[model samples]
Target: MTPEDHGTEALSGWGRTMRRVCEVRRPDFDGSLLDAVLGAPRLTVRGAGKSYGDAALPVNGVGAVLDLTAFDRIVSFDEGNGVVVVEGGAVLKDVIDQTLPIGWKLPVVPGTERITIGGAIASDVHGKNHPGAGSFGHHVLWIALLRSDGAIVQLSAIQDADGFWATIGGMGLTGVILRAAIQLQRVDTGWMIRNRRRTRSLDETIAAMRAGGTRQELDPERHVVAWLDAHTHGASLGRGIVDEYYAASTLDLPGAVAPFPETRSPGSRRRRSLPGPGVVTGATIAAASAARWHLSRSANSQLVTMRSALCPLDRADGWPAAFGRSGLVQYQFAVPPNEVGTIHEVLAYLGTHGLTPALATLKNLGLGTAGPLSFPIPGWTLAVDLPARLLRPGIMHPIDKLVAGAGGRVYLAKDAVTDPELFPLMYPRWPAWRRTRHRLDPAGRWTSGLAERLGLLS
Candidate 1:
């Protein structure tokens, strides 16, 4: 079991925060995977590096960062049953390209399709349709996990449920995700019928979500989300646009599942990369926010590709660069149905500090997941992206306490700075998840920067 030395390299997640220098290694397929996991002194598995924080990084700037992109492969697909077997490193976009041609798509996907299947499972990512589709883990039929003891085991909801759920949102602390068999959903086209509604206030935005049903009941067919303008104040505070979508098949002629178009959307050619810090400011954000609101207000119903409807940020590519060198911190928290005030309080806190969030969205999350560490619960969730420079310890800490007190939890995938002391309160199931994670890797061989910071590695 020998490993190759790729030398030391600097690594960070999508947010470009907490950059760490770590020894790096890339193992080839089959026998090489086992050798890589067993031969390394200590390491963390990284896939596409799409997580917003340190979950993919090495702790304390030491250890090997295992690059698994080479393991990407679509092993096979059972079109009859809508199940596809893919390597852990397989990207979601690739899966969609191949499977969609045959009338199948990933049952659940995150905002960015560039993320790897392995990352999705490790994070248990959710989408705009979370209330109906749940998180990525719910769609996984089984995972082939490489444990710390050098054993490969198969896990599923029914078989080895403890190991399975633990690995779902365990932040790669349990073991290496070798691959997985995923259940796909059928789609007739690659497009969605989108409708936009302008909301006057935060209350109206949430009421639109409840319009589908009760505050808790979200219509499965209609994918819903809202874009908020944090710059507005007084009567206009929380003014935003709400978007509702139905699959193209619901209104258009049903046909073979189509692939994402090769041609880019108009104005996408003008997209630019983030050059450095100080590019994003309150003034720039306000202008952009106003432009977005006015543009949506003019359109009521339109035909948009699933890519446009689901992952609009993908078009901007390196848009986060606008946040400058300090990058950005995305604080996404979810609360129960009755605790709606938490949203108002947090937003008002940001407004009072004059730190306008550059980007914000609100959605209704449905069922709580079986994975103990999974973030979503049945209620409303709001995610705000603020420039790292503008956010101080004084601000985030209070928001943390507010969220924890409201019986809510932050999304570990998007979190970079939450006091470890507040973790247990936010995620009460941590003890159970930790126990299962320990049983899978009793030596605590699988750990990351996030695991260590949040005291998940004991």
Candidate 2:
């Protein structure tokens, strides 16, 4: 082990709001990574750097970072059991491209397919089917973790149970995840049967979603999600389209087994940047929202490709960068069924404050994972993207208080400016996660800006 410094570089989250300068080491060899872990004083492991906040950045805006992009690889696959072993740095898109053609896909996935396997586990990301399939951690079978003491240990729900669950959503503070084995869901085809409806108000939307899944049903694995028009106010507040779909059971649909949507190669597409800072203003969002709402109507059941169903936004190249250099902030929070009122409160606040988001999505999450740091809890979750320039300092403070009071917690993966004092209140199980993290790395070698800000580091 050697205490050598790598070149320093500036980094930011997907939101492009939080920026930091840190020493980064991109070790292509496994031995070099081990040495860096054993020698670096304060370090954090970075994956694809897709987290909307500072979860991948170093502590206090400075420290050593282990870049694992070159470490990406699909180790093996078992067609019999639909299990695939992949390096932590492997992107989900690549995995989908490899497996989807063979009639298998990840059991659960987030909004974007560009993130790394390590990132999916660290965030315990949930998708539209969260009402049934749960989050990413639920699909993980085992993990190879590199601890601060330089020992590479295998973890599972049964083996080193505490470490396994903690690292699931511990935001990489537990240690550096080298690789993991995940279970894949079987699909006869790459097409989905979509059942969409336009809700008239917030109550109607909630009723439609609750009446749908998130509980027992003929097709328990059905995916359900809602798109909200944030520009609406008063009676129209929360009016949006609710969609529920399941994989096509038959191969009769058009393009039922179409080749995997070719993911964009790096630098292959030119992005159209926003012309001005206020290009995404309230007026613009209102017009766009209305157009989208009116245009969403279609047959109750229609056939669409999996890629179009799961990650529709991928079609727009560099959409985030379109928010201008200041980037955007994605605020996502979850609340139990009884506390559904919190959603209305937040939406009302946004309306009163005139903060219209470009995109807002809502879903019903089933029971959460045993991982103490996991974000979902059997309830309603809403996510909205707001341009950084549109926000005022402390604007989110009241929303945080409301969520915590309702016994809900914000998603740390997309959170950039959550109040440290309120984090524990929202996540009451923080102490348990902290204890497990400390047990894994007592020297506190693994730390990130998110951990430091939210007091996750011991």
Residue 418 lDDT (model 1): 89
Could you tell me how far off, in angstroms, the CA of residue 77 lies in candidate 2 after the best superposition? 0.7
Clashes by residue pair, model 2: none
Residues 382-410, candidate 1: write the lDDT tens digits.
99998888776767888999999999999
Tell me the deviation in Å of residue 424 in model 2.
1.0
Candidate 1 local lDDT, residue 163 = 93
| TM per prediction | 0.94, 0.94
After superposing candidate 2, which stretches have Cα over 4 Å from the reference? 1-5, 214-220, 254-278
Q: Once model 1 is optimally superposed onto the true structure by TM-score, how far is the C-alpha of residue 223 displaced, in angstroms?
A: 1.1
Please give the range of 10 consecutive residues that has the lowest summed lDDT in model 2.
Answer: 261-270
Error of 2 at 318 (Å): 1.8
